[model samples]
Target: MEKPAELQAANYDLVARDTKSVGAYVKSGAPYVWVTAAAISVAFIITVALLLLTAARGLPHFWPADLVQATYKEPGKEQQHLLAEIRSSEEVTTARLLNAGLPVDEKQPLYDRLLLKIANRDLGGVDFRYVLSDWLVERSQPKDATVLERMEWGNFHGFVVALKEGDKVVASGEEAWKGYQERQDRVNDLRGKVRDIEKGKIGAVNYDLERLRLQQRRLELDGKTPERNAADFAAIEAKRKSENEKYEVLRTELDQLNAEMGRDALVMKTVDGQEVTLPLSKLIQGYRPNDMGLFPKIGFFLGAIWHFVSEEPREANTEGGIFPAIFGTVMMVMIMSVIVTPFGILAALYLREYAKQGPLTQAIRIAVNNLAGVPSIVFGMFGLGFFVYFVGANIDKALYQEGLPSPTFGTPGILWASLTLALLTLPVVIVATEEGLARIPRSIREASLALGATKAETLWKVVLPMASPAMMTGLILAIARAAGEVAPLMLVGVVKLAPSLPLDGNVPFVHFERKFMHLGFHIYDVGFQSPNVEAARPLVYATAFLLVLVILLLNLSAIRIRNKLRERYKALEH
Candidate 1:
């Protein structure tokens, strides 16, 4: 062996070399850089995958898949014709089948079963059924099979028997299809006219009547007696009568249109061989999905998507489009952003720019940070108590005493929902704005002051302009949180269904006091509360996808605005 000193020196040299290598690695920051990059990349991949999965499930809901007509017969059961769409399929164990009291072949360890959407809720108590794959003796997609998307009682799947005008047979076979199509076009046009008159003309007139009543009450409160305001009341009364006369004419036209649409009916035969006499006006759409070519299917798919996005929901939001939900979500987010930004920015300005730096200021900053983590539902409760019950009831008592007992603003509504969300997101905005103000170089403020600008002027012009991006960043975060927040909205304003949109032909153009549908609430309602879970499954996925899409869009809009602002103030940084 070598001398002890020489051996010790060699060990020290090796240890020093290793330490130097580690130090160099730490100085380069490669480990942290790689870790950060990996985290970001993984997050991106997960987000993209989640989005793709949502699309795969949700987008297919609109596609016109060919309905399968299968003949199912088990050992002891009679043969049956299954005329329905195969919604899904799964492999089930024989043991599980036995437990459910289903007939199972002992020879087979597993069996395939299909979840079928056998629509025609009027005829069948159940809309979905599970049939063993092995039990289906034969299956076919008949070109003559037709499906009708009705206004009520869900979808009707069958074959067209004949076209009838009153009790007279107008056409049969090929000509019947043509006649039905033509008649359907007329019915659609008539329906549109009725909707316009009912919602636009009549609704606007009703709004004015309510306003006139409020006006009369106001006149009374001001001590302007009937004699003094006789001309005003007379003018109002004249307008009201004129509008009523117009409404009566529209109602007459609507009655005539309904009669015209009711004149024709289609004799449709159900899958179980029951003949259904369906009115032309009751059917929203009738199509043969089995016979549709690729282009036609694409067209049908596009039309389905359009209807889903444009039309009002029906059947407890299990069927039809979610246009109102979409509109409410967007409008509420916009209102919330508007309400939060000014208040948040002002609070931040006062704290950072004007308030003295002390332990008290430090405590406030800490408290604001802590507020960001508070449960959203708590804010909703506060809003309901403070905004709806207290503020709104007082406003009702003061402004519209005539409308007392029937509280106008003393309820959950769009305004309350928006305000609640604003409160929930306020801390985020405040923190972000404060950080943004802090980021402005002291030299910039000094330079502005040197130029004889007031403290407020420097903040208003120089500091705030540069802080715009941060405000947007805060807004982006706020929207990301608020748009998907179902818990707070539930207590604040969202309803399972709304008869009319918050925005309509009503006065003020928007009804802030009205309850509205939200996509998040729609998802929750359809997924949990709907009587038909299997029927509502597709809608749940679709609504979830739409909610995500809406949030993404809101964030993108804010980001675009922020980028433009950043570009405008880019020179200030230099």
Candidate 2:
């Protein structure tokens, strides 16, 4: 064996060799590359995990869960029965349970709790309740249990008691459910007719009446009174009379439809044996969730999803469809793209090809870069003041004087919202377009000019086409940013609910001056501003996932177009 000092000397030599190897590795920058790759992988994983969590929380809500019937045996409390759907579960400390006034044993360290969706808001005055899992007994799913989705209240979970026409009971008990199923289709049809009359024919008549009133006001403003323009005045009066006649007919039809809808009523019995009468007009649908098989449940889930995306909201935006919001978001993004493309391209063209390369141009570029960093709410405020109050007000005074005080265009609207987003995204487009223009070879422009083409023609036919891909890239970024914006839209145009769409079969097909609902704003409202926090939680997740999906789809489309443009122009690079 070697001496102790010699052994220490050998160990020191090995340590020095290992340290040198580590130093060489650091100098080669391998650690930085690995760290960067690791960071990207971690970010990707986190993103996917969050999306999965959101889907887990949201998508299952539409799965038509079995209704649970249970008997509860709480300490020192009388036995009680519960009919609900299991919303969620959690583990709690015994101390926390005791603090909540539950009779939890001191010796127990933890207890399980269940969130039950009771959903009889009218009777129980609440939609959800938490119960101790240990105390629940005799749990089962009854086939006869029914769930009623309503237009006003949240939902009703009970059993079918009777079906009645006016004061006459048409069916009772099990037969009542069969009778309901028989008349369900007819009730839905009548409801559709009522909706059509109210929102279609009657709405058109009302619109015409308003237009006639505005026309009369315009004549007065132009100093063309009945004495000066007898024919015009008489024509307006005749049209008004005709519109009134149409209104009377529509009103009669609407009244008859409403009366027919009110003829039937449904009686439901609660789990605790209390009977309640619900109007058939108020009930949207009813089903026995506990009795559905896998395929039936899947079908119901699909139908529910369709209803969510297709129907207008009801019950404080907590129930029904979000079609209006979806339409508004897409419309706003498209309008913004249209408005931004021209302005952004023109500005980029001027800067890259026409403007002198001096301090002024550099200063302008710096200012644009700074604009992108500014908070979006500031842009919203500027739009409100400049676009709405200044420009829109002036337009209203100049061309829409008949609607002066009401301020037709002098309000926060879809047009102003699009303009605001265009302004917000202008810097992005300008930068991307300029970069693309810079990439076009100087030889290409010269060749086109030498081939007897004017400078303008060369730019329009050659340079712009080649740079189209970059412009699309910028547009994709803009859509991604604008579609998810809630704060700016809230101030500019978005509302909780819009009664009518911005587009219709009416003249001037696109109504730029209309306030509209947006998916981003819908998510914000449903998530934060709702009255029922528990009921709205899952919906919040669903809306967020939907907003992300919309942005992704818009980005994907732009990316596809960009790729095609790149391929088309690939030969020009050579």
Candidate 3:
């Protein structure tokens, strides 16, 4: 008994040493590890949050319904009605409004009023019918028409002038008066020319009429024969027709002169009166929907944060919201995960559990690894060739031949994009799953078999559950990568704006055959294809941040699930 006790000393000593070592490591390193992890996580979260908030703030100026409205109450009288809901209590002067955040030039006084500042520019001058909220009207006071003479919104200057109807002379400034006088001279000359043409035509017609009358009277008074009288009448009629033709030509010329004068008159009247100086195009640009002011900006920012953090459902058809893209991305990733997961797991199981470690297995593993390293763009090309062209064409022919030239399935669509992404990510799933399967202890399998459990039972109950967490991790990574992918989607199924979403209410709903808008594609379209580059820049940044948030959310969820699984399996390790 003493010898047995002594023999056991080595085992007891080894167990005690292991416990002390582990305890020492935990005591020395645990706090630092946790602190570093917390700091990194906080920093990352804060950075993302701030970026999203900034984007929201920048986007709120696109819509201005709450700010102010321009209404033409009468033909010549235009009124700006301010919306009460959107305005702050602080009274803003017209000059302050115009130069709120812009530079002012000394030459332009009208730029001080935001409304006038915008109205002075071409883009802002376009007639807009709007209903302003009450708050905006209350906070904004009428700007003195005289004050506009000195205020400059930007490089341009403003002026006020009184105009005589149809006169080209600006009545306020000396230069304007000179321009007006010049225009008036031109207009007077045009009118004189038109009057002269009209008088000449009238004289010619009168003379022709008199000559015809005289000829008729002479034929009757001289007692001419019927033939002579008829000839005289015909001559008179011909003369009258000729005079009428000449009068018509003169009238036409007069009309042309009048039209030219009218255009000049309009130019003189519109430009010479109370002229507001600004770059014509920039001032007249219409407000967009996103310009909902600070409150909406904050709301949108919070909504975005919630969307990225929580699993709440979103509205399906709101514009400028990330809901549709998020839905499409999740739907596509889920479909891909479902498609690739089984295949990847089965392949891994066969290679690690059933197949012998021979050259064939090694070669297969090498190929899988190589596939993982292949350029994603190459996969996109292959997908376009095989899935979009070959398989899709056949499907189109078989199911949708009635819509023949349209090529429903033969075209790039969400289904094909998902399948292509599935293929591209399959190698990742396979490699991860295989590594997880390989990490399993051989003794677990042996013990299960010795306990009368079949190979399938052991794999399904023990191996699969143990390996599930890792498989999910791989799927998450694949999804994140796929969701952010733009190049492949561009060639396969993306569009600038899809008239209908992929999932909508229709017969046999869920139209995978149609193109869809994606967040990544949206950023691309806004950045490169939009007509308004300056306006689209902020939107691009906002969209990019949203896409990043989506990927992070997916990864975080996957990690959470992995942690839960780890905790559940902890007892097994003991």
Candidate 4:
């Protein structure tokens, strides 16, 4: 063998030759290579932009008052049916009105003219004309009223009574008036009672003292003035306690009565103002059933967009405005990145730095490459069987016996989905990081070693810093892969509509056992399960676009981080 110095010189010459050849190829900028690279980059950017645009279009709008009003218009058939029902009602005097239309006394003629005017004029396209109960018509002057005005003013009962029973009409009107008068009287009486109670409470102590003094004087006059003994004192104390209890009971009753009176007054005021009666609980039950047309569409569009960007907390679904899928996807990606990055980098380091160029390492390299080629669905199956059923079941049994049958960790959830994805991405990350590690100069590592640095120290202080750009590149690739993964997540965690959010105000805030929605699944659901096909098609496109955009964003962030790392390590490149 040649001397060690000579052997070192030969190795250096070989490295120099390889570097020169690589530099020449890079400078040449072959047409095919440049074209392919530019095409890919442009396609990726266009795809991402399209996705974002699609998601934005999917967002709901909530504006323009006219649209809202138009949506509330009843369906045509329903309107016609309501009109027919009103016309057929017995309250309407079809024959008499027809006769009056021909010719009659001035008052009868006026009634005919008014009826004709209302019948001819469209009540703002409101199909059903009110037919007032006979009572309402009798209460008003005969020739001056229109049913539309009565219905619009919350006189439905009066309108119906006027139409149906003429005798009952008079009775109902009198009863309504009487009821109103009685309620008003009761309200006034309660108000007076409350005022009196307030005054009594203020003067109560003085009144009690006077009464006690009068009793003491009576006892003295009767020559029965008791000694200041314990029994006599107890008797006086008991009397005082009884009086105090009576006063307290009276005050509580007065307060309760006052509250009831206030509520009644509110109701009466609302009725007088012609406000539609609706219970507070019913009002808060959900969105109003009537469509406000354009406004609701607009609101839905904006709401969808807000749901897209707000990192969908759990409350997104409950009150019906938020979405949690976007948040879960992001969270899964972050967790996957944490699990894959370091392990990938270390594996790559061993392969590129410490491993010998032998059959064993080469075989390992082939296996890793083949792992990446394995179908993603197969990986999902493996994960489900091994991680979810096997490992998770054991964990559930050991840690959550009390919550048995209701599994804690023994389900396919966000956690399992994330881990499954990490495994699926491991090969990609390893290959990328290995390629990066290979690009690093061997001379730099050797130089560090020569400076009396241990192998670990050299890797930590020198090799790692120089290779950081490559490591970031690997991470970016991993993020891109993880973000777009849907098939695996479907089997693992994704659901149609989870009743509760994964993160809530429960004991353990983040309930990983909970299923989650995903944009991919949303698209699928809309396309396949939506009741209205035509209406849902556009929504499918919108959801698909959003899913694509999310993946693009992750890739873009990774690119940015890689670029920053490149800048930081630029000095070391030489």
Q: lDDT, candidate 2, residue 8?
A: 95
lDDT of all the models against the reference? 0.88, 0.91, 0.60, 0.57
Error of 3 at 235 (Å): 77
Clashing pairs in 1: none
Clashing pairs in 2: none
The segments of candidate 3 whose C-alpha lies over 4 angstroms from its true place after superposition are 1-323
True-structure lDDT of candidate 1: 0.88
lDDT: which candidate is best? 2
Kindly list the per-residue Cα lDDT of model 2 for residues 381-451, writing each as its tens digit. 99999999999999999999998799888999999999999999999999999999999999999999999
Tens-place lDDT digits, model 1, residues 225-340: 76877887787778878878877887888899889988889998876688889998898888899889999999999999999999988887888899999998998898999999
**Ranking by lDDT, best first?**
2, 1, 3, 4
By lDDT, is 1 or 4 better? Answer: 1
User: Which portions of model 2 show Cα errors greater than 4 Å?
Assistant: 1-37
lDDT of candidate 4 over 1-574, digit per residue (tens) = 6579988999999878866796666766775698999999999999778766765555422111110110112222221211111222243344565554522233432221111011211222332243323212212122111121111211121111111121222223234333433554565576567656654552454456545555554455546645745465457667777777878787787879766564421111111123232111111111211223566757754654564455222211211222566766777788788988888888998998889989999999999999988888887888788878888889977765545576667888888887898889888888888887777788888888888999999888887877877877777878877777777877888787655566754345677777776666666766787553433554566566667768878888888888887888888768
Q: Determine which window of 10 residues in candidate 4 has minimal summed lDDT.
A: 63-72
- What TM-score would each prediction reach against the true structure? 0.94, 0.93, 0.53, 0.54
